[model samples]
Target: MSALTGAAAVAGCGGDDAGGTSSNSPGATSGGAERDCSLKHPVCTAVTSDCVAVHDNQGATTLGLRMAQLTITKPDVLASGYVAGLVTQGLTMNLPQCNLNGTGTFSWLLEFDTTTGKLRTGGAMPTVDPREGYCFANMTAGEFEIAPTEIDAPLTDGAWSGEAETLNVPIFLETSPEPIILPLHQVRLTDAKVSADNNCIGRYNVEGLEWDNACLPGQDGDPPAFINGGKLAAFITLEEVDRVIVDAVKQSLCVVLSGDIVKYGTGADTNTCKRDENDQIVLKGDWCSATNSPATDDCADAYALGGEYAASAVKINGLCPQ
Candidate 1:
């Protein structure tokens, strides 16, 4: 799998600038003439043309990274939510292919005893591809509780509980030219409470989450990354495990001295996560580019077009079983 490789500073949060003359800015002057390069520009044939490729690629990479992290770090949480309805009848989870060559197919035949909240594999568990870095084999046996009868508990209405142990899981991030791979060592999740309402939409929220040695790159030397606070929300269905929709917002501080990356703050500045009315994650932003020409310099209005220019970059909707 292609992972983002570079310093975090250069791979800053994705966003569009209001107005700038930087060549990297989408709406910069093409020539000496003032030209309106916004989507409404009469001369500009396509306003979103520049934003399409980068936007879509970034969105896909982000979604894939999030899904892979969730899957690798906490399979029990997923099993409980995706297969909650089949507790008594039993089910085999056929994971969809996540790679380009259609090879990361995984299967788990699980039988759940709803009466005792015990879960066990019915047959030999399929070996997860090591290249994918998801430790599925460690989830062979576990216990789960769907619709726990606890009162005054958050997500009590449709909550699932489970636990697992993960070692050296890899998480990917997008940089300017390449992807960066970070190794999370000795990670463990216990008392994981996942919400199964609306088909496991609340599976992103976890309880008792801990990790060690997240080796992030730095100038002086590699430093351990820290998470001050964050919220990750996802919507997933059992039929499609590969195309999980996710919205993640994190508040953290890191010293990246290698590249020119954006520093994320703690408030709305970190609200890069966006979702639609249906609670499905959506890429929201405009890609406005302007010519240097004086006639088309007013590309500021391009931001107001108000539509997802990176719709083609989304893959979660079509992540059906293959």
Candidate 2:
């Protein structure tokens, strides 16, 4: 947290022309309402979520984000069959749990908060129904949990950054016997900003999303105390990939099509498939062997994951059933 001075109010939040304190200053609250994140989210019990509390004197704004997509670009985690492709698609699927369609209540939320002095972010569950609108599930958190539960970063000039060792990413795959948990490591989030436009954009990391200056929200160039868009980079070692996912990958990759882990040839030969003496198209290390996969393009050890994501804004209309 650096010193804030000289018209340092966030973009959307109004600041005093005098550069002191105003009704719209960063220290201002929502109409002097109690700053209790628990009030916004009733479903997020202490046992599951990290509740956020608004101090009596602090000014803060909270944004409830639903996971729009988590697309994995690196490693080419494609499948050998249609079933496998469907499984891989789950990582980027637009599930209806967001309550925007038929109204199946679900929750996978993150709280992006810009307080008077710090930038805080945390995740919690929200049981929202389409009829009920946004649940704003209790986003209260104490001391931003480590090991990747919740994190706090320095908001420098409206840009903040932080790193975590690993995080448990719960991704529901359609072709799995059970839910799939993606354990990510060496996680790094960079280029976080909240302005009319900046080099960084979007709330997620993945491929195929095109967000630029023209696509950003806001008008004035002034940045806020909290950041919005940035790049999320992480790594997943071969060992880190779950056996079930490996099995899923095996179903779609040629390397394991024959029920054996057939790696590519020695040397710089990184081919997706090669014909053997019998002319059978055999799968090699080409699946996760992308240049950015891991081990510096040597896919024998890991896979590189990258992406850009977009988030839908929702107003906290009501609380969820306790």
Candidate 3:
């Protein structure tokens, strides 16, 4: 988010007998108003010149939070496939408002070649490994708005409630049990709050979230079985978040996720994934057994789901350090 100064109120002046004119020009006032609008105002165009900047800041922050949650609750997937080499390119964001009842949306096409650099594989489950691939998300039509009732005034000083439509993104998993297109949908982030200043959001909190990946059929046409629903809470100072974004632009972004993640629903079966006393993820199940088998392999069944598998901890190319 960028800081914008509000337009200075111009007093309308009455012409004098000598036909004196106001010092402020109409064009100048209009331009200034346009500049001050954006998120600075309660409403503005979704697509603006600073759209990329805003998205890079806010979007990346959102993604980082998501990654942090994934690392804490799904370390198996984060370690083996969703590594740090991934980056999103060609992004376009359209935020219609910076307050409640306003739309916050964006869409982007991905370029994995730049991020992965090369294909690589080797992990507990050799079936799926980190590899180069592509992904795209078109969430421009989704609704994003603030909750007026939750706002503590001074507008930019206190916690603010916000909500965004569920995200549906398509990803190409090149090295899974079989290369396939996985459409992750029904991904909702709820009870979100942002602590902010006039310039940016210093920290954010998400109370509940859910993402389902049952779009594709399983082996032999079985029902797709990856479902993740949980709650995530984390903190990242805006300054630190900005640095990460800068590094990411240079293709050097390394994110170390350290946070609290709670899993629920069908995914909480064994409850073996948990955080250590130091807040690092700790994996506890056998990772080598086949799914639903009587075998004692801890993570095998979990790992098979790729992005859906939960883990206690994850370190990705030094990005997500233990």
Query: What is the clash count for each candidate, in the order shown?
Result: 29, 17, 14
lDDT of 1 at 129: 31
lDDT of 2 by residue, 128-228 (tens): 23223344333222221212245665455656666766665543333443333445666666665532222123532112111221111112211211123
| Model 3 lDDT tens row, 206-309 | 11111121111122112211122222221212112112221111210112221112331112322223445874334332233334222253332222122221
Q: Which stretches of candidate 2 lie over 4 Å from their true place?
A: 1-60, 78-108, 116-148, 173-177, 195-229, 246-300, 314-322
The TM-score values for the models, in the order shown, are 0.19, 0.43, 0.21
Better-scoring candidate (TM-score), 2 or 3 = 2
Give the best candidate by lDDT. 2
If the candidates were sorted by their TM-score against the true structure, best first, what order would they fall in?
A: 2, 3, 1
lDDT per residue (tens digit) for residues 61-151 in model 1: 1221111111211222222222111110111111111101111222221222333444222111122332222222222111211111111
Better of 1 and 2 by lDDT: 2
Candidate scoring better on TM-score of 1 and 3: 3
lDDT of 1 at 175: 14
- List runs of model 1 lying over 4 Å from the truth: 1-113, 119-156, 160-187, 190-322
Model 1: lowest-lDDT 10 consecutive positions: 305-314
How high is the lDDT of residue 220 in model 3? Answer: 18
